[model samples]
Target chain A: MSKTLISARGLRKSYGKRNSKFEALRGVTLNIHEGESVAIIGKSGSGKSTLMHLLALLDKPTRGEITLNGHPTARLRAHKLNTIRNKKFGFVFQSFFMNANDTVLNNVILPLKIAGVGYRERHRRAVSALKTVDLDDKRNNKASDLSGGQKQRVCIARAIVNDPKVIFADEPTGNLDSATGEKIINLLFKLNREKGITLIIVTHDQDLANKCERQINIKDGRIVSDTSADAEQDDDGDEEIREIIAESEEDDDEDATPDKFEGDNNIDGMLDQKHPVHHINIDEDEEDL
Target chain B: MKFLDIIRDANANLLRNKLRSFLTILAIFIGSFSIISTSAIQAGVNNFIDQQVDSYGGEGYLAVVSKDSFDALEGLTGAMGNGNSTPIEYKEDKIQDGMTPITNEQLDKIKKIDGIDGDSLVEQKSLNISYVSSKKTDKKYLIGAEALPPGNIKVETTTSGQLDLQGDEYQIQLEKKYVDVLGYTEENIIGEKIQLVVVDQFKHTQKTFNVKVVGVIAPGVISMGYSYVNNKTADDIYTENTKYYPAEYKDHVVAIAVNYDYKNHSAKEIKDKLEDIGLSAMTIDDIIGSIKTFFDVILTVFKIFGFIALLAAAIGIINTLFMSVQERTREIGLDKALGMSSARVFLSFSIEAISLGFWGSVFGITVSMILGNIANNIFHAEGGFLESFPSFNLATYTIKDIIIVTVLIMFISFLAGTLPARRAASKNPIDALRYE
Candidate 1:
């Protein structure tokens, strides 16, 4: 719909070295346009997440060229890159990634705080962002007190608080129940449609990827296929995606995708164990009783 | 980030672990408290010594006496006394054995000495002084009034507000007890006439004269019985009284005030020169110098203890800050990911350390000042708990000293925080984010 917001060419990321060198992303080239909704989809360790990270500017690629809004970022200094990350991008993670001890409002205000906004202005903007996510009444509550879906909503609010040019959600709804996950996907689509914010998601959920206008399937550290649907008629092309999903499900039993969790046995695992239930279900059960 | 925002962030981070932050501040507190308290006490003692030295004939005047009389005056002034009636057994040693007093020839030799401005004869005649109220019969107040050379005596206002002495006034600084016998307050005693009767026991003849009281001084070592008189007037009175004395007693002078500009000549040089001329000289500075050395030694010992406590506190700061960095790993990563530069991260931690030092020093100084004032109040009350000791403040810290101590504490804290801050700054955001 618009000029390229972020473009990456010949991106590569490898772990270990020499004989043990294992590449997570190899020669990935993609361009994401402004206000576009794109999903990088693959099973675990298929280099989809690594490709997203490369586009997000969270890590330096071993070899690549990334142009952000037509500015070459290959040689930008770390501090300059951090400024770009703060002012131009926002990120959401699978585990909600909220600071459990801080208030809901502080969680959303963090990006603005890093941007060095004054306290009163930060408070006002954070409150407005929370209201956008319908969490304004819970502004003073610690993140630990929020339910899983609410925590994800808070993460979205934080991601949009700086009003960045792009939002990166890596498995944003992976931990939520199906109904809640559907709501979160709808929220991401609504932001893309209403606010004209670019949305890039890394996920394996076929149902979620079929909703986007563009879907790139990564397999064995390479792009196996790129598919696009008419923006107003993405549902008309979902039948084809459903067939593809059925074929992948048959292959799931024999799935041998490399375990991304093998070396990633720290953050994601720790976050998952930190708050599994969110206790909202138990509270609802008590209310039912 | 702006510098103020960085400080604000650091403040919030420190609050995350309240107990650790408070403990670190307390360590700095202990160190600053000891240093401030010791400095206050040292300042108090130094102020007292300065006042006492000022009260004793301070500068530019030398006490010229015989080697024996020099020793006697040193004993009279050095010993702790109220300076009323403690005579220096002047009749026993040299005078009874027929040794000649300081003669006019000796005075001329001193006046001719290089660097000598002018000299005056000190009237050492034993005079029985009495306040001339109507009733005065058998109470004889023996006082020694010295007539100092020109420009040697400077009268300063005492607590009772005595008037400044004018030219050629016949005045006496009466003893505290003696003034009380006359039923006159120190302020009212000015311009009152006092009778002085010089008695020559060998000749059995007494000469009497009346002198007007001018300035009143609290009796101390320098002036026994608050005794100071105008040089010319006392010289005239002495000459009048000695008109009938025999030849042996006519040339008898106990001491002389040698008026050398001592700024060019050190006290040691003057004392040595006088000794060459068969005389001895002493300055108030020489005596006070030794006393100052004693106080300085005590203060040095106190400072050593304070420094040791400070060293221990510095170690405590290092320990606390290092632990804080370790615990705040994830938080630090979050800040970096939020676009905080490594330099800002480092500065934030450093500012936190400095703030810890600031609060510690501020609290320590405030509490110590309160305690010091309380102690001083106790020591200054009527018949104070410390009445047996000399009347002086026990602790007094100046604003300059307080500022210096606070800055010193902050600097040490900043230094102690450097290593920990560097560690936090150099932490890889990826690894720190991965840290649980």
Candidate 2:
């Protein structure tokens, strides 16, 4: 099985202090493996964004710990955290945050600039990233002058410019029309499949959640349902079998329906076996049943 | 972020709101202009005074007088313009007319003092010359001439050679005005002889002494338009004028010019020693120090105004930067979220302030220099106030003052920037992103 890129256990997050304190996340336990496209599905205020923030190392958890590549991130200094965020992770926000007055190429160059890349090399990398998004022609155009879809594409270019290992997208298509959103979704999955980059997307859209290999539904800061646990018993035995299935699935690439449900099934099964506590937490939160 | 990137971004940010930045820089320019202009003017005045001091017998030379005579001179000047002031009472011990002579005992003590160059001592005797004439013109002109002091004395001259202090030949450095009146141009008069007639007071008999013209003196406030003569010529002329007086009165010296070891002892130290011997001494600074003090007072007042303007400019920097911080809240949040450190954000803002100061001071210095040069040219031209003093510059810019002003203004800008920079650094990325 692929190595776990990020693992969290009993993570909790809160805001304010004492009487006015509020809990954003009670406890979330999950493991995201390398190259897996996982969707964290939830409504607003469900703490899915908070979980993503902790998993991406953009913030510190109030309780418990998160380990990136088996190193406990809680003990790392702020500077180290910033370096990790800059080098190892990418982010695509829903609002498409950008320096609007700057050129599109400059917006994409932000992450590489922060990493202290040389000017010529960073420019080269930014142009290549923009090419990947098919927006290289707009390199010199002001970011504000672009359409909403183009702006999101430019934001995606900025996200991947530093060659990050993981891309945490906070509602990547939240502001787009369905037609443009589908194109963005296709591009994200294409990068995941081609470059082997792990994708952790936080979204409420059911259609988008179903497109990923695994869907973890968060309700009131607790994971209520995770589809990966149902096939836990077949994890070790199914790796070789799943590879055969994956090979055959690649043959019928145009048939999107069957591939969506069955793709990477064994990979999800491996998750529940290693982390029994995550399964137990889901069982305990199933009081509605 | 790299430091260069932070600085570039800072300058770029300033351009985003060009009008506001320009106005802030304008305020800073006002303060810098006034300050640097004053410093330049002060430097120019000091340069002119230093030249004057060098011409008047230099740093080591002092004019020594008996303490009583010095005090009586001060009293006489003080008693003027006030009719109510009492007249001096007669005293048997003190000289009645305030012209007390330096006794032979005091003269002996003066020569014995440490650091005093005994050979450099020359009594400042006023020679009563009847009139001066040159062979080119029969016209006799009234002229005042004194013996040149000892040591490295460089009298400002239009055209001249050094005066030989011990030369037996009588040498005179005639003033520019007398050069024309005696029918000799400055260039052609060198090596020529002029006649100085000294008439005895009692006998009314005259002895004409021929003195060679060595140099032409440039007009200066310190020289007072008086020509300088060599020691031999001055001694002969004094002897001829006072030949009939009592032999004891011949040595009644009121003042003497002397040189001392200026490198080993300060002028004040030597003055103190002279004071102990019942004598008073005035250094070159003591004589012309009032001019410097007057300029210093006026310059200091202008400098105070400059600082006050700077204080106001500092407040303007704070206000401008604060508004910038507020306007760029979301942009700052984006940078912070993208992993730009709090310190870097603070640095970027601080750099913006420094850039403002840098531009302001650069503009101030450039404009002031241009204006100063123009003023110098205008004043040095014909019919200008400074026309007579060709060697005097109205303004002088030194590299040290330029650096000092730039550094000081930038430092003040950084101090002013701290308030807004702290605000920017302390902003929470999440909250800042949420800001509209």
Candidate 3:
């Protein structure tokens, strides 16, 4: 019943000169509706990332027609395209591309900063996002100090902090262990269900593919199969993911030494509220406190 | 992105690469340092020369000499062309004929010319003076007295116009160092009378007179230590010394000069009138202007060397910014992907370049000013190398020139940054993100 948010027709992308030219995507067509959890599953060199890039407006296809909210975006100027990208779309890459020198809160708040949001409001929202991911206690830690799973969590927080209409995650838990991977999946699914945001995930993991409501299989730059799951939701899967998150939370508490918990108690007090009251300013020095 | 946010991001990025940023700034520092130092030295030298010239010459004055003294051979040739058949008996008086002064008739004639407001006669008579109250009686000082045309003589006076030499009070001016020879303090020697023995060159006899000292003047590079006699006293001595000379040679004035208001008359017109009457006039401005022109050429040459250094520094900035663009390809791509416009990205890098110029010039000016003070102490020290030179400064700092150099360097840095900023702005976001 959801309206279509983005639709692409006859998308084509090629690389290099005529004699040495290689095609990445060939006449691929697809439609993604709002509030739908969709996954594009493909092997290596199958152009799932290329399709994601075009849909996100991060690139221009060699030959294609793309429409967003009923407006054709193929001829839109760069600034307008960037505006759409900044306001409506959020991306989480497989590599967890975070500024190593910046604090966890700063990494989460960068999009708002770029969007020219006020200092106090962005700080509040960044803290709320971090708390949702259960990393509010580590908001002041440098991004480099975080473990791989924790890094991925920060990336997710950054992706959702702006409340975008759609979230594009490419192999969201590819680098984590099974327990950490399950925790990431639970966070992503919680955001999708709670916010009603359209979620598009590209992954080779079949277990991750089964959780989505719809799946598109791409091979050799073509869609081989497009299938949709039944209306019956996976209650058992949700319960199992919740159990994994609970065990990880217990482990996180055991490892939280006195030094790590210094300012964390104050953070927990702020996050305990449905909405934080004190408007903290988001700056480099404010993170340490 | 907002302009302020872009600037802040640029600052943070530069701070992350502190060593590279500092090294780039050092190159600009060297360039600006040379420019500031050279400009200071030039200003100092020119300022000193201007002060020296002002003190050396009274403003708006002209100098004139007797036509015979100015054109000695021409007058003699004209006098011989009168066609007297008898071969003139050439004796001492005949040998001194060409050295005659401007006659009273000539002075009266000049007074009637247009724009000739007033005239004065400079008496040229050699006299020997001895401080009468001094312990050293054997030392006699040779002095010359004259009513010199305003610009001809350069004398530095400690107390100007203290004595009216034309008044009947028979007074004289003594040199400042006469205190040492007279064996008395400066205050004590003011009212003292000194004996002068006038030795006439033509008459070959000495006549003695005593004149009271009224004021003191200092000795300088141009004017050595010579005492002054009042105008009335000078006339009396001149009449007595030449009393036995031939009647025809008796009434000649030493020199005849005229004064005209500078505001009313042009120098060219005055010079033209004087030349018509077979006389020449020299103005102080003409002499000073010619001297300054010589120094200006030397200053221009020094400035060229500073400009060359700045040009090299500009090239260094361009190269450094290009390298930074290459190194931060992925970062730029991320920024673009995050919703930064191409203009904002260009502006961010441009601001970073300007900041480099700002720091370099600020440091250059500060360090140069400190060094200028140190050099001032060494070169302008008492009895130092520059001591013999009057009113000389080793370095002089001016605010206007420093601001100009800073602006020029910043402009060059901005121009150099444009190439790399454009390259960054025009980059394809997908390609940049894939830079790896």
Candidate 4:
């Protein structure tokens, strides 16, 4: 497994009356691996989104520490935080909060723009990103003119355009129709698979949670079940997995691109398993040659 | 962010409310324009006064009131009585034994004074008479006369036979206007022909002297001050007003030219000195009563106008800036979040106001120039009072006008922007982000 890139210990956020502090995240702790795809699952007010915000350094913890890529985040200056946010993190909110006044092309180029990207190169990258979302023809269309689903897709393009190390989505499908939501999820995972970029998503949808290799269920900001799909059941031997499985050297092809084995290599309902050894072997084979 | 982005974004935002922006700029333009125009006109008046004074030789000489000089006689009728009063209803038929005349000795004494450049003595015959030709004409008194002084005063009379006033000065240099008109009344008046009957109370001289109309001398805008009068003792006593002397007539009115080299000086010093010598001197400033007084009435009217216009312009600026603040609330929030200080926000808005003011002043000045020129030409064509004298020129050019207008506009804009910019900058980023 990759080293932990971010860790939040006892993170909490509260809102409301002076005497009544309605804690959003009550002592939440979570770890995101360097390149892992992790999904946080819970019903409404489960503190999943709050936890994501804390992890992304978008919110400060009221009573705890949030360390991002190994550096403590609470004491960071605003300029330094902005720089880190610009270069390291990308966001895909549920509503795809696009600036309604600008064209799709401008929206796609906004992050690069805030980074002071040159006009020509910025447009070129923006166009390429739009093409990736299959919305290149609509690049000049105002964001207000786009449908809910199309806007979300464009937002995803904007997020990945910077080639950031982590893409954090807060209920990436909360606003879209069922089919469109599924499409966005598929697109997100596909891009994650292709780029080996970390994807941290928080969602209430069980179907979405079923797809990620690791699932964390937050019950009152405490991670009640942080079980991996096949983690030897923490010495108690329990997994929803009918089967279990998964998984650098910068060179020598040891951590090279995971090649396609050219077969019906499907890993579905793989979260249920008795022993995780056999799936672990497949991960090892997937590692190098 | 790139500089271009900031410019383009600002332009785009400003475009959303074009009327507001234009009105803002218009306020600036009018404000700056009025200021420059007002200043230029003030400059014009100053220039005019200076030109009028300078055109008549220099400013050192004063018109004084010596008890025996001719001006004292005229000024004594000023309702302000002379030192110790005796109304001289008529000229003294004879030089009284006790009477003081400004004599040649006094002139010589003045010549001995350290700074006496020169002097001129004057006599005047201010009486009116009538003449009937085949028709008739109004009896115009000698419209103008030069009171010649001592031979040492160097009276330059342009009379017949080249009788140099330096060598053989005459009684008067009469204008040919009288002789030329005499031809209509009498016959063959040009040369060796006509005579004028000279009469002025106790005086009737009908001796037909040869009409030596040597030259027509008219005092123009620039005339030399070398004219002088011969001593009264030099003239033969020919019974009051019937004498044609070989030397210039004794006008018995003295003018002392004090040698002052400075442009601006205390006239009181010279006056006090003259007063010690039993002469009363009044400076140019005393005569004109300070150039600033000429502006009192006009300035009062103009200041009221300027005040009202400036107030309106200020309102325009404040309104536009407040709108800008409201429109760019989120953008300002974003900037603040990016660690921009409130002062930077203030500076940006203030600079924008200055820019608006700057352009307006340029336009205003252009209007003033074009309009001022048109006014001058029209007034001159109509033979108006301003046209009769001359113009005060303080011409400005493209570079100079631009620089001046820009500065004025920006300064006023800076003044106008203060409250608005402060209000905008004071908003907290958190509230501003949530602001509509």
The numbered model that scores best in TM-score is: 2
Interface RMSD for every prediction, one decimal?
A: 7.4, 6.1, 7.3, 10.1
DockQ, Cα level, model 3: 0.26
**Candidate 3 residue-wise lDDT, B1-436, digit = tens:** 5567777777787787888878888888888888888788878866765555555554446555555455554455555786433333344643365454655666665667666565543434543332233333557555655432343233445654355645776667777766557665567767777666666566667677776777666654333456566667766766766677788666655544445556777878877776676666666656566656776677677678767877777777788778888988876887787777888778888887787787888888889999988888877678777754435666888888799989988888888888888998887766776676
lDDT rank order: 2, 1, 3, 4
User: How much is the lDDT of residue A121 in candidate 2?
Assistant: 95
- Tens-digit per-residue lDDT, B149-233, candidate 4: 2222222222332223433423233343444553432123212322222343344543322222333322222213222112231
Q: After superposition, how far is residue A157 of candidate 2 from its true place, in Å?
A: 0.7
How good is the docking of model 1, by CAPRI class?
acceptable
RMSD of each: 9.2, 8.1, 12.6, 12.3
| Per-residue lDDT of model 1, residues B128-214, tens digit only | 332233133455655656554433454432434332344565666555555666666777767777777766545656666676677
User: Which one wins by TM-score: 1 or 3?
Assistant: 1
TM-score (second chain) of model 1:
0.77
Candidate 2 per-residue C-alpha lDDT over A1-289 given as tens digits, one digit per residue, 9 for 90 to 100: 5788898877788989999998877766778888988888766676788888789776788987899999999999878887888888888888888899999999999988888888999999999999999999999999999998999999889989988899988888777887788778778888888888899998776567666778776655665456664322212333455445535544433222222344455433533232211111112211110
lDDT of each: 0.71, 0.83, 0.70, 0.57
Q: Give me the runs in candidate 4 sitting further than 4 Å from their true place.
A: A9-26, A37-63, A93-99, A153-163, A168-172, A200-289, B47-257, B263-317, B321-324, B327-377, B380-405, B411-436
Q: DockQ winner between 1 and 3, please give it.
A: 3
**DockQ in order:** 0.23, 0.28, 0.26, 0.11
Q: List, residue by residue over A1-289, the lDDT tens digit for candidate 1.
A: 4688888776778988899999886666677788877878776777887787678776788886789988889899988988987888887777776778899999999888888898899999999988888899999999999999999999999989988888988888777997788778778877887888888987776556655667777765665555532212112223455446445754552222222112221222322332222212211111000
As a whole number from 0 to 100, the lDDT of residue B226 in candidate 3 is 60
